[model samples]
Target: MITDRHYEIIVYGATPGGIGAAVAAARRGRRTLLLEPSPYIGGMMTSGLGRTDIDWLDASGAIYREFAHRVEAHYTAQYGTASPEAEACNRGMFFEPSVARAILEDMLAAESRLTLVRRSELLSAEAVDGRLTAIAIETEAGEGEWQGRSALSADVFIDGTYEGDLAAMAGVPYEVGRESRDEWNEEYAGVLYMNFGPSKEVLPGSTGEGDDRIQAYNYRLCLTDVPENRVAPGKPASYNREEYASLSVDAAEGRVRSIRDVLNILPVPGGKTDTNNHHYCMCSSDLPEENGTYLEGGREERQRVRDRHRHYYQGLLWFLQHDESLPEAFREDAQRWGYAADEFADTDNFPPQLYVREGRRILGEYRFTENDARLAPGLGRSPIHADSVAVGAYAIDSHATRKREAAGRNVALEGFLGLGWLTEVYQIPYGVMVPLGVDGLLVPVAVSATHMGLGTIRMEPCWMQLGYAAGVAADLAIAGGAAPRDIPIDNLQDELLAADQLIGFYRDIDASGLMGKAIQYFGAKGAFRSYEARPDEPLTVERASALLALARLLPGGSRFPALPAAGAVLPAGADMGPRLPREEPSPAAYWQRHPLLTQGLAGRWLQAAGRALSAGTAGAAGGSVSASAAARASSPAAAWLRTDSAAAAEGGPSASGGAGEAAPAVSVGEWCALLYGLLLEARRAGSSGSGGR
Candidate 1:
C-alpha cells in the first residue's frame, strides 16, 4: 500500500545537519527529499537537548546563524523579550523541546522544494557499477524505493544521520576509537595512563574520575524548574538503577559529587537552561564503545541501548531529586527542574533520539588528523578541491576509550584542551565531505576524517556549516553531471566564498565585506544582544534590554516593550548601531563604509595581533632557555627567535607595529602579496594540504 517517491537529491537523517543539508539542497534549486526515522525533526535541538555546544560562532555559515536567529526570534515573540530565563525556570539559552520541533517543521513547511518523510527507516541500498543506485526504505505505512541513491545515480547523497547510519549502510570504510600514538605520532593518542595532578580513584570510566579512557553514555534530561510547568520524571518500563549502582556508590564515596558535574549548561531565553551531558564524568553520555558496534547492531539492539540510556538518566534524576543520601542543596536544585509542561508531551518528556557524538567516519581520499588540529605546517597546501564550506575553532576533545588507573587513581583523561593559537580557525576541506569509492555519496556529519580531527569539528555549529556545504556540493554535482569528489575546487570555492562561508585564515575584501553585512543584518535583527555577548561588561537587567534592542531582537520603537513602563527608559536613537566614541566608529559602520578596505584592515590587524602575542609568549619562555644556552653558546634565545619568526611568518603581526593600530592603506596588489606570503609559509610549514589520504 506504499508508493515510491523520486527526487533529485535525498538526505538521510533529520538531525540539525540533515535539516541544514536539505535546506541547502533545496535552496540550490534541487529537488530534495529528507527522510527521518522519527516523526519530529530538529534532532537534538528539538529533542531533549535544548542546549547547544557551539564553537566558532563567528565562523558559522548563514544557514546556521539564521537558525539561531530564528530561535531568538521565537523567544522574543513569545516573551516580548528574548530572556527565556526570566520567564521560565530552566534559565539558559534553552527552550522547550517542542518549540524547536515547531520551528523546524515551520522551516520545512515554508520550503516547497523540500519533502519530509517521517517514521521512515533506510533498510538497504542498491548499487550498480560500484555506485549506489537506489535505496529501499520501510515506513509505518508501507515500503518504497528510491533510485539514484548512490554517488553516480543521485548527484550526491548526504549522510546527515547522527549515527552516520546511512554512510555505514553504504559500506564505506570508517574507524572508531583512539588511534595509538604510533599511528599518527600524536602526543595524546591511545590509552593515556598518566595522571598530571590531584584526582580521585573512582571507576576508570566514571565521569570526572580522570580515567584514562572515554566516559560512558547517558541521556540529557530536559527538565523544567517551574512548578506549574514541570512534569515529574517518569520511570522507563525497563528501568534499572542497579546497573548504575557503581556510579551511585562512587557519588556516595565522594568520587562523583553531582550528576551536573560535567553538564554543559547553555542558557536559553527566560530562566530555562538546556543541559548537555557530553563531557567526562557526570552523565558522560558519549558512547565511544557503542559507536563502533552501531553498524552491526540490529534495530532491536539499538532500541535497547537507547532505552538503557533513558532509564539510566531517569534513575539518576530520581536519585538526585528524592534520594535521602543526596545533599539538601543538590536535592533542592534537582527538584526545581523537571520536564516542561508544554514541551515533549510524549514519551514522558524524554528526547526521542540519543545524541550520537561520533559515528562511522568515512576513509575517503583525505583524512583529517591531530596534525590538522595542531594546524601543523603545510597542512592545508593541496587543499581538498571542494568549495571551502565552514570553519571550526574548538580544541581537539576526545573522551577516554577505556577506563584505566593513572598514578594510583581512577581519572578520565579525555577532556578539552585549547589549541594555543588564537583567532586562528581551521577550514573544513571540501574533500572531507566526499566519500571515497562512493561516487555520489557526500557525508556532512561523519565525513572521512581521523578521530582527533573530529574532536573540534563535531560541534553543532560546525556540523551545521558542514551540512550546508555538503548540500551545496550535492546540488553542484547533480547539475554538472560530475561526481562530488570530481567537482573542481575553484568552482566550489567561488560559490562558497560568495555564500559568505569562512574558508581559511586568509580573507579577501569580498568575503570580509559579506561578513560585515551579515553582522549588521544580525545586529539589526537583534540577535547579538545577549548578556553573554559582553559578560565582562557591567550592565543592569534594564540596560541589558537596551543593548539587546540594538540587535533589533527587541521592539525598536517601544522602550522596553516587555519591561514595565517605569523601567523601560528608551535611549535616544537606540536603533542606531552600538554607542561608540566619536573617534571610534562601530564595526558595522567601518565595514559598511569601506567593505573591502575594512576587511583588509581588520585582517591585517588580527594577523599583527597574533604575531605580537606569540612573540611575547615565546619570548618569555625563551628567556630561561637563553640563560642555559648562553653557558654553552646555545642560547634558547635563538630558539625563541626562530619560534617567534615562524609565528610571525604565519600571519602574525610584523615586529614593528602594534596589532590595534591600523596600518597605512596598501594597494590590492600589495595586500595580495601579503596574503600570498602567508599562504606560501603555511604550505612550507606543512600546515596546508588535503587531509589524510
Candidate 2:
C-alpha cells in the first residue's frame, strides 16, 4: 500500500460532498487525496437514495449542476431528448444509482491532481497543538492501488463522512443526539411527535426536554415492478417473523396500506423508485433506537447494524407479501414490488449504505438553530448571514427516533418532525464548518448545527455546496499559512463568486452577473432584507433613504411616514426619512406613485455613503448585517422563497427594511447595482455617496 507521503489536502469519504471538496481543492492546484471506507463513492446518491433532496437547482451552484447535467445527459443520449425517459431524469435529480456513480467517477477522473482510494477506512488520527497532523487508515484487501494499514499526513483535512468519524478520531468535540429546547431555543428540540399533513401539528406527550436519542436510520432501497427485469425478494438470511409482527398489525389498521405507505417510494427514471422509510407510519422500515448503537459502535458493530436493518426490512416485506394475517388487497399491493434487476446487482439488489440521517455534529464556532431558518420578526428574509458559505432550503425535517412502546394504540411515534412550518431558505455560515479549537480540518457532511438546524442543512446538495466552499477555503488557507477561520473572507468569497457558488441568496438578480455581486454585497451590508422578487418596482424614497442609512451602519431606525388615510399608494409629497433635504445638493423628495427616488439622485447619495462607511471600516462580513445571525430578532420574514415557489411569491408580507417602504423610481436591484458600480467607479477615480455637489 502506498503510505508515508505528505499531502496538501486529504479528504475522508467519497460522498458527493467529499468529491466536491477534493475536486475544488485539486482544481485550485492543491494535491488532494480522497479516501473512501467502502467500495462505493457517491454515498447515498449512488446508493439507492435516488430522488434529489434539494428545492432550487438554479441556486445550488456549479458542482451540483454539473452532476445533474451528466445524469440527464446519460438518459437523453439513449432515449431521445424529448422522450419520457429523459423527462423522468429531471436533470439528474431523479436517477439510477449506478449511473450516478459512473458520472461522479468521470468527474473525478478529469482532475489530475486528485487521487481517490476506495475501501479505505480511517483507523486513528493525530492532532498536535489543536491542528490535525496525521491519520491512520486501513484499506481492505483489494486489487486497487492502496490496501492495508497506511498513514497519511496532510496540511489540511476534511471530515466528509456521513458519520463524523475522522472528526471524532481527531479529538473534535462532537455530540450525538438532540439538544434541549431551552439550550438552543429551538422549537422542535428534544422528544416530540407531530402529525404531518396540510399542516404539522405537534401531538401530546411531546416534551421540549432534550434526550440522547437521534433520528432513525434506514436504507434507501431501489425497487421496481418492471415485469421483465423484476427480481422477487427472497426471505433475508436471518428472517424473524416476530420482528415483523408490528408491520402486520400496522397493515391491519390500514396505516400501512401498500408498500407505498411503508416507504417513501418516489419514482425515478426506468420504472424504479428510490424507496426510503416513511416517518409518519407507526411501524415501518425505520428502527429508531437501533441506530444509536450503530452511531457509537465500531466498524464491525456498524456492519452488524447495517445487516440488522437489511434483514429487518427484508423480513417485513416477506411478511407483508406472504402472511395471511394481512389483507389480501394489501398483500397484492406489496407483491407488485421487487428489487430493480439493474441496481445493486452485486448485493442482491439491495443498497449497501445505511441512511445515517445524522451523525456526530461537532461543537463549532457557530451552532445554527431552528430559529435561523425562520424569518426575522422585522426583516424581509431570514436574518442576513454576512459570513454565509452556502445556503440550506429544506425544512426542519427529522424522522422518528423511537418506536411507540404500545404498538396497538394510535399514539404518534416520538421524534418524527416533517414540519416545514415557517421554514425559510437560510444561509450557512463559515463558522459552522470550522470546529471551535480544531485547526486544519473542516466538517461538511457531519456539520456543526443543532439537531433542528440539521433539518435544513442535512441535504446532499447543500453539503456539496458547503464542501465546495471548504475546499476553496483550504486552498486559500494554505496559501496564506493561516487557519480556516483566520483567512481573508473576501478572497474566499471572491473565489466562490467566480466559481458561481452563492454566498447570499437574492430572488431578482441573476447570481452570475455583476448586479448579483452588488446585491449580495449590499444585502450582506444590511441593505436588502427579503428574497422576494427584486425590489424592482421603482425605489421608494423611503427605501432609498433606508438603504443609504443602513450602509452607514447607524444605530437607530426610522419608521416610514404613515400612509395616506385612503390612497392605494403613498402621496407624491409624503415625508420619507429624517433630514434628507438638509444634505448638500439634496433634491426635494418627489411624491410619485412609482419611483420616488431616481437613479441619478441615488448614485450621488451612495458615493457619499460609501466614503463614509468605508472610511470608518469596510462593512464587516465578520458579523451579521445589523442583527447578529444568532440574534433572536422576531422580524417578519419576508417572502424570500416567492421567486422560487409561485405560491410563496404570491403570498407573505416582506417589510423592506422600513415600515412605510413600498413601490415608488430606480429598482432596488438597479439601485444596489448602480450604487455598487459607482462605489467601484469612485474607488477607481481616486475619490466617493456625496449627495452630488
* Residue 557 lDDT, candidate 1, scale 0-100: 17
Off by over 4 Å in 1: 1-4, 81-96, 142-153, 193-216, 235-259, 262-266, 278-292, 327-329, 377-387, 403-410, 413-424, 505-665, 668-693
Q: What is candidate 1's lDDT per residue for 296-365, written digit by digit as tens? A: 5788887877876676667666766676665677667767777766666677667777766666677777
Worst 10 residues of 2 by lDDT: 628-637
Give Cα-based local distance difference scores for all models.
Answer: 0.55, 0.73
Stretches of model 2 off by over 4 angstroms after superposition: 1-3, 143-145, 407-411, 533-535, 539-666, 674-693
> Could you say which candidate leads in lDDT?
2
Q: Candidates' TM-scores?
A: 0.67, 0.82
User: lDDT by residue for model 2 over 1-693, one digit each (tens)?
Assistant: 467888999999988789889999999999999999998888999998888788767667767877898888899998989988799998778898988888999999999999988888888999999999899988887836566788889999998898988989888898888898899888778877676555566677778888888888888888898888788989878988887677777776777777777777888889988888775567678887898787679878999999989898998789878888888898898898989988888888899888888998998988888888889889878877767777777777888887766521454677887657688877788888889777999998888888998877888888888889989999989998998878756456657766888777877778776567667766655566688547456666677656655533312112112222111222235453453434523122224433365332332233233334333456422211221111112211111211112222122211122333342235666655544443443333333233210
